[model samples]
Target chain A: MISSPENTAAVNIHRDDIGTRMGIWLFLFTELLLFGGMFFIYSIYRFLHQNEFHLAALELNVIVGTFNTAILLTSSLTIALSIAAIQNDNKKLSVILQIMTLVLGAAFLVNKYFEWMAKINHGIYPGSDLLLSKKPGEILFFGLYYVMTGLHGLHVIIGMVLIAVMLRLTVRNKIDSNNFVRLEAAGLYWHLVDIIWIFLFPLFYLIT
Target chain B: MENMPEQNQKKNNTGYTKYILVWFTLIILTGLTVSLAGMDLGRITVATALLIASIKSSLVLSVFMHLKSEQKAFKVFVLVALFFIVVSFVLLFSDYSSY
Candidate 1:
């Protein structure tokens, strides 16, 4: 190996593609376990109160849930496409796709806001007096609904911010065809968000 | 290690059409789950919805997340994590169901 200034700089930068990707995957698994705990609690409660679970699920608007699911799904597609575009050296297309992803994520959150407000307006929030008057099973159902969906919404915000950062990097030529690990990592995070919603939509809105 | 290039050497440029096809399939699966929700399938509805969801997640994992092209170590790590989750589920259910 020849000792040189450029070699020293390259070593200092240290682009370890395989290691970076593996680290992200490990982080993602921890995230899965974090939500997995909640899913377990929900299953146990649902089993104990099947009837209330069914009736409480009816309060959710399946149409809105489905529409939001589609939005997240489309967002996942856009992020995936952005990665592909970057991999193909099409920087412009990648930026466009990332913007589309951010738009779709915002759209999903808007729909969620309206859906939550509709329930809140009817006094169905976690500790509202109206909720207190409901049966224990129904109360538990709504409580879990709020907590799970709220946490998922938080993940959406984090993912959007990460993608936005990646967009800036892409524009600055920090993320390009030969150096796109950051963008790929961001894409993985976004897809994981989408996957979580895939299970959440069916479990919360479609199973009843 | 010192002489390694800073640029990533991964040249696998998956086409746009493949992702679109996967997206189409995911949409169809989403539609199926929603439509099935309207029916009174009793206990089977849960199973059907979850099964479809599992399929959809697998698609996202393998394709969109690039898990398919990832190294064997990544796949093994994923399986290990999933195995632990399954074990936890089984243990929790065994205790609760027995009670």
Candidate 2:
């Protein structure tokens, strides 16, 4: 084996691919567990106060929750398509698809804002008098509702930024067809976000 | 952005039509689950909704995430991760089930 710099660089680059994917998967696993722990709390609380949790869920807008689910689902599709475009070396289509994904993400956030605003306007926000006056179980339900959904919303923003960065790189030819796992990694993260929402929807909005 | 072979390798790209098909199926599933929630099916509603959601996410994991095309080692890791999540839930619930 020649110990030349070129040989080392080539091996390292290939290894880096597998290594990076493993790293991202590891990171995502942690994220899943983090939310899993929270879901644990949710289950315990719901079991302790099934009635209140049902009431709390009734306060949520199933329509909005369903719409947001659709938006996230659509975004996931667009992200997958964008990766396919990149793998096919059609950078233009990849960029276009990415832009569409970004738009869908923004739409999700926009709907989220309106949903939260409606709650706030109705004095149903965290720490509001209505919440403080509720039974402990109901309070916990809403608290977890806000916290979990808020965290999911944050991930949406992060995912959007990631897609945007990928789009920029694709446009600049930094992420080409031969090497677009980074974009695939982004898609994976986005799908994870969608997956979390899938569970959250049934737990929070549909359990009634 | 790692994982490229030294020589450019041609990876199988899922067609746009297939993606659209998966996307459509996902949307239809979403609608079904939402409407299922509205029906007064007692305990069955929760079970049914969750079961449908699980199906949708499975479609997403296999297609959108390309888990089907992924390496065997990676697939095993994913399975293990999922197994642990279930284990954690069961173990933690054991404590609460008594309470």
Candidate 3:
């Protein structure tokens, strides 16, 4: 019946205890299936109109895409370090690293803001402009582009919130060496975001 | 295996070195991919770029994400996801070619 400082739950619970780990894994599997559906749609559309997809992709900003990829990769590294720090019982370092990761995630979103703005400035909105030579296929391409990348961006926002929660937990000493599963779960989500970008980079920016 | 091995031992291992080296290689590979975009490689350009990106992703998954060290069930989960991804791609391609 030990009481936790931040909550009424037990304080010495093993972070990666079997049940907790299993639950997180289940949630992760659901996430995979969810995104997997979207990827399927993307493949269908891209394969049907390869030329249109490639031409539409050429309109994207490679510099911003590359920068965002690098930013997300660095955030993944920092989150991994945060997990390592917590496992080492370095509470302060863990909190700082978590905050740093959050900041980097936000920075990536900000860059995305400018990138989207640039797209709009070029009159690339869905169903509105025939800026490219592809005609009807361009509309489909932009539709999938917005839906896929928009969903990915929403995940990034959620990841930021998750990290913030873990930061609070670390500050209250609820996420020490013995119980750092939350950080690991959040780290897993962050890495998945990075993985999404790994595919997106080529699909959007490297088109012929 | 209640805990990860000692920090010093883990740090000294070849895997750690390989992870850092892969990160460096990723940076260079990204630059090369973008630079090559200037040249007209036709559709093959996208294929080649994606191939490199996939390789980089595998390195990150195996090392930084610690997929190689995770439990067998977790590994199976990832494999299952990949299996379905392949299935979806195949199905989509078949439908796409019918058009």
Candidate 4:
């Protein structure tokens, strides 16, 4: 299977080569910087409107936020284990763990759905219709809230697609001990999503 | 296949173990951060929470993602990205705090 020109010579290019892997890390690092900018903006606004932000944050359901945090943490563990399984050349185990990770990710989205539903039901939305009957600053806080978490949720969706692609690669025997960079890349993306939530949990749910 | 390096062999086993341990530690840290949030420690709360999050991100980057094992050039790429980010934050916040 290593017969391709990319697989020849002392420097292997069997999908897990240093160059390809570095490319993936470079991609992930760019993603980190992108989200880092958004986070910096959030922090600036939070600092400026600490009282309003905290009051707005208190309107969120801590129960749902905590559950989503736990769910994402478990999913990160599953993805890490999946990568480990691939490195050990355990194909079936890797696939199983990937599917488990996918399930956990979907569960997180579902929990988020209910959380947003609760928020909507309580009238704690953005725009002029926002609840929490406070000041204009408080309404702006919810504006940032919807923008940040909604963008984060969109990232979670993108991460699920990335994981599915990795799973397909695994099923086709394209991933193994000699070539698992894609899985590693996807895992890095998933962990970034988890890290984003780690910040979001405190910013939106616990700041009060 | 017969002449694989011993370091590779050690990496195949111990590396995987270390990743699993990091995962477990992350989960524990998540729970700890959540509980700590309940204490209402004022400004320190967000700072402490973000500090833990940074550590968790570092573990994931270095271990499960194998950033620590990468080439110096690649490490420099990441460091450069982070450096720019910090610079931007500093500039922005300086303008912010002045207002």
TM-score of each: 0.94, 0.92, 0.84, 0.87
Of the candidates numbered 3 and 4, which has the greater DockQ value?
A: 4
Residue pairs in steric clash, candidate 2? A17-B2, A17-B3
DockQ, candidate 1, vs. native dimer: 0.73
Candidate 2, residue A61: the lDDT equals 94
List interface RMSDs for the candidates, in order: 1.7, 2.0, 3.7, 2.8
* 1 or 3, greater by lDDT: 1
lDDT of 1 at A101: 99
Q: Candidate 3: how many backbone clashes?
A: 0
TM-score of chain B of each: 0.86, 0.84, 0.74, 0.82
lDDT of 1 by residue, A57-134 (tens): 989999999999999999999999999898888999999999999999999999999999999999899999999998
Best-to-worst order by DockQ is 1, 2, 4, 3
Clashing residue pairs in all predictions, respectively, total: 0, 2, 0, 0
Best-performing candidate as measured by lDDT:
1
Tell me model 4's lDDT, rounded to 2 decimals: 0.78
lDDT of each: 0.90, 0.86, 0.75, 0.78
RMSD of 2: 3.3
The candidate, 2 or 4, that scores higher on DockQ is 2
Where model 3 places Cα greater than 4 Å from the true spot, the runs are: A1-18, A129-134, B1-22
Residue A201 lDDT, candidate 2, scale 0-100: 85
lDDT of 3 by residue, A61-120 (tens): 888988988887778777877877776677887788899899999999999888888888
At residue A70, candidate 1 shows an lDDT of 91
